[model samples]
Target chain A: QQPVQSPQAVILREGEDAVINCSSSKALYSVHWYRQKHGEAPIFLMILLKGGEQKGHDKISASFNEKKQQSSLYLTASQLSYSGTYFCGPKRGGADGLTFGKGTHLIIQP
Target chain B: EADIYQTPRYLVIGTGKKITLECSQTMGHDKMYWYQQDPGMELHLIHYSYGVNSTEKGDLSSESTVSRIRTEHFPLTLESARPSHTSQYLCASSGSTSGKETQYFGPGTRLLVL
Candidate 1:
């Protein structure tokens, strides 16, 4: 099943912070995050593994709550470069393919 | 940079035409995947392969078929294209199943079926 992402879209001013959340009904082995700019493929950001692991990249950080079957990505002190659509890909069991959330469109305005 | 390549950055074709989207990776990754995405939408996995000669259908049912004839190449073919197939096709590869191994994506092929 596809995960659910909250706040389908968000707008933030420079240096502001924002959070994008992803929740799934199924048990997740890992949660992967990626950001995609206009007309481009997604770029890997971070991966949160099971057993409550956290990962970060630059000002972007994410945490996976296994018990809640949810993940949250944090963007701190946002920059214009941070404007993009963020997707959460969840890995269930031993499957190679990931189930992705609809996506959260983030806009950082100067 | 990761060595994943996709050919034909953009393609426009008429209905009933056959088309193949090419994807290649030099990272020696064992797993490759093909995903379809519309503008401002989430990626939907259409097909994937674990290794050479191994192919599997993803959660989303697709009209496309893929081949893993070699380790570096995984191509998706549509025998008959339709307007519904108009979207961006992304190719990705991962080194392992650990999830920590980030999946590297190609630039993608944007197809417009008229």
Candidate 2:
């Protein structure tokens, strides 16, 4: 089943912070985060494995809670370049095909 | 910086036309996948391959078929395209590394069946 993403869409001002949450009914093995600009491919942002591991990028971070079967991506000091659709995909067991959420539309205003 | 590529960035064709979407990756990834995405919507996995000669259907039932004759190439073919088949086809590849199966994507082919 596809994971659920919160805040279907969000508008943010530059330098503001936003959080996107993804939860799945099934247990998760790893969570993958990707960002896609208009008419472009989804770019890999980060991947959070099980064991409650957290990964971060420049002002972009993500956390995975294995027990909760959920993941959260944090966009700190959001920039205009951060404007895009964010997708969270959680992998369960040996499944190679990832089921992506509907995606969280993030708009950052200058 | 992943070297995945897709051909025919955009295609507009009439219904009943046969088409093939090509995807190739130079990163030597063991796994490759094809995902169909509608504009501003979630992606649905159509097909995937673990390596050359190993193709499998994805969670979403797709009418298109895929082939993995070479490790770096996975192509999708539609014998007879329909309007319902119009969608963005995204190709992605990932290495076999455990706990680090981060997939890198191609620019994608936006297909339009008239």
**Candidate whose DockQ is highest:** 2
Q: Which portions of model 1 miss their true places by more than 4 Å?
A: B97-99
- Candidate 1's DockQ is 0.78
Tens-place lDDT per residue, model 2, B1-114, is 899999989999999999999999999988999999999998888898888899999889999999999999999999999999999999999985765888899999999999
Error of 1 at B113 (Å): 1.3
Per-prediction TM-score, please?
Answer: 0.97, 0.97
lDDT (C-alpha) at residue A46 in model 2: 90
Candidate 2 matches the true fold with a TM-score of 0.97
Worst 10 residues of 1 chain B by lDDT: B94-103
Report the Cα interface RMSD of each model, rounded to 1 decimal.
1.4, 1.3
- For model 1 the local lDDT of residue B11 reads 96
Q: Candidate 2 chain B: minimum summed lDDT over ten consecutive residues — where?
A: B94-103
Q: What is the clash count for each candidate, in the order shown?
A: 0, 0
- Model 1, span B1-113: residue lDDT tens: 88999998999999999999999999999899999999988899999998999999998899999999999999999999999999999999988654466789999999999
> Which candidate number maximizes TM-score?
2
Q: Candidate 1 recovers what fraction of true contacts?
A: 0.82
DockQ of each: 0.78, 0.79
